[model samples]
Target: MISAKFRVQLPEGIWVADTSRAFPDATFRLLSGLRIGEKAVELGEVIADDPQAIIDRPQSSIDGWELLEATDERALTKYETTDIELYEFVESSALTVEFPVVVRDGWYEFDLTGTRDDLERFGDALDEAGQPYELQSIVGTTDPESLLTDRQRELLDAALQAGYFEVPRDCTLAELAETLGVDKSTASTVLRTGEAKLVAWFLTGPKQN
Candidate 1:
């Protein structure tokens, strides 16, 4: 299985998008949702200073909206909407959506898990529909260690432990080589080759063969 992360700019005039843009400081989480005939019903939570004001405001694309609960900084709501294009696409593609679709800065960010083919098809469909989206990453479920040799894994672990990969690196190439008792050239070659393999596996998948 593969898990793909996506960030989609919600179309203008949608309630959630408009509200999020209006209150950029607030966070809106679409916890769960389902389609009911031509309408889509969703349950969500809003984290804001004035949740009641948001609940009272009028919005487009919504047939019904109700605030189920509210506190000083949070609100729970149930709403039914007519803007179902994105919802329909997700349902028809047979991909499983992770909950709590985050809404901020007029964008909906979420993860969808499925086979590679299904995810590719879904992305294509979104493009055909002219929806604006960004594919952040596609991560395979397989363990990354399975793709590396024992030596590669050992070097990587040592590098990590020595803070070689840190923002302000604590260990230099010479130090790393000394720790492994290897010549500088051999250590550099092994580290570079291993890094390339890991990058390839992350962007695509494990090499076949």
Candidate 2:
């Protein structure tokens, strides 16, 4: 199977037109979900760089979504919708994908492993449904290892070469930062975020379809 990554505009993406308009800085990270009879409930995290007063009114700030929990960095919420094509796309395509899917700014970015025919089929389905989408990109495969950003990849490569991940730890964070020409904190964040994404990549599953 081939792996492809692309961003498409989906009208079925309810979050963008709904809550994001209120707070442009907040991004909804879908974790998992369940069905309550006819309605559905999604449990996910909301990261807001400019949190503003949204957290204070979590109970009512979001429209369709119901805030079930909150923390300093993110908020957990539940909402109901009947968009089966979307939830199904997480697994339904001949492609294999992980969730919660990345959706924001009026688009859904999909990273999936499948064949070209599979992508065409999915796109055709979208056309038939009258849901217009922009195909952003297509690549040959995906994995936990392919998720790293350039800076993160550079730092990881440097760290590995210097034995930073080794038990004895050949290099310090400062040394790695210096090697990459970045500050300690910058290097730390790149490595940390990259590591976290890799961990999440490994642990990804339990789709709430």
Candidate 3:
């Protein structure tokens, strides 16, 4: 199995897109959704200074909207929408979506987990449909630690202790190499490879066996 992160451009005419674009500073998180025929019922939350703006915004695609809860900084809402292109596409594909789907700056960012073949097919479908998307990362295995070697783990731990990954790195690569008693080139290769694995692991998240 493989997990991938994708950032997709919101399709035109979708209420989520319209609202998100209208309130660029606000964050919309789709907590859950259910498709009913050509429409969909979604439960979501908005994080913004004026959470009421989302409730006040008039959108033609939204058939019904109800505010479930609200605070100064956030609001929970349930709404029915006629725009279900993305939802239908995911339903037709073999991929499984991991919510809450985040919307900000006119983009929908979400994670998908599936077999390699399923992911390839979903990518092909997106291309055929002319949907703009960015594949952020892909991890082959769910067990992140399993991807690292013993030596790599040891070096990464040492680097962490030395603050090599800090904003203003406490130690230089040469310094780390010297401490590990290895040449700079070997240390560099190991660190680079190990870092890539760690990043991929972080993106995909660890799954239970």
Give me the runs in candidate 1 sitting further than 4 Å from their true place: 142-209
Deviating ranges (above 4 Å) for candidate 2: 12-16, 34-37, 49-69, 78-85, 88-97, 141-209
For 56-126, candidate 2 gives per-residue lDDT tens digits of 54332233766676667666656665544455654455444444456675566655544567778877777
Ranking by lDDT: 3, 1, 2
Q: Relative to the unseen true structure, what is the C-alpha lDDT of residue 191 in candidate 3, on a scale of 0 to 100?
A: 77
- Candidate maximizing TM-score: 3
Instruction: Report the lDDT of model 2 for residue 124.
Output: 78
lDDT of 3 by residue, 29-103 (tens): 887677899998887889999988777888888878888888999998788988888678887775545556899
Model 2: residue 15 alpha-carbon error in angstroms = 4.6
Stretches of candidate 3 above 4 Å error? 142-209
Compare candidates 1 and 2 on TM-score and give the better one: 1
Residues 29-145 of candidate 1 have per-residue lDDT tens digits of 877677788988887889998988877778767767777777999997888988776677787776645565899979999877555888889888889878899999877766666
* RMSD values, in order shown: 14.7, 9.5, 13.9
lDDT of 3: 0.80
Candidates' TM-scores? 0.63, 0.51, 0.66
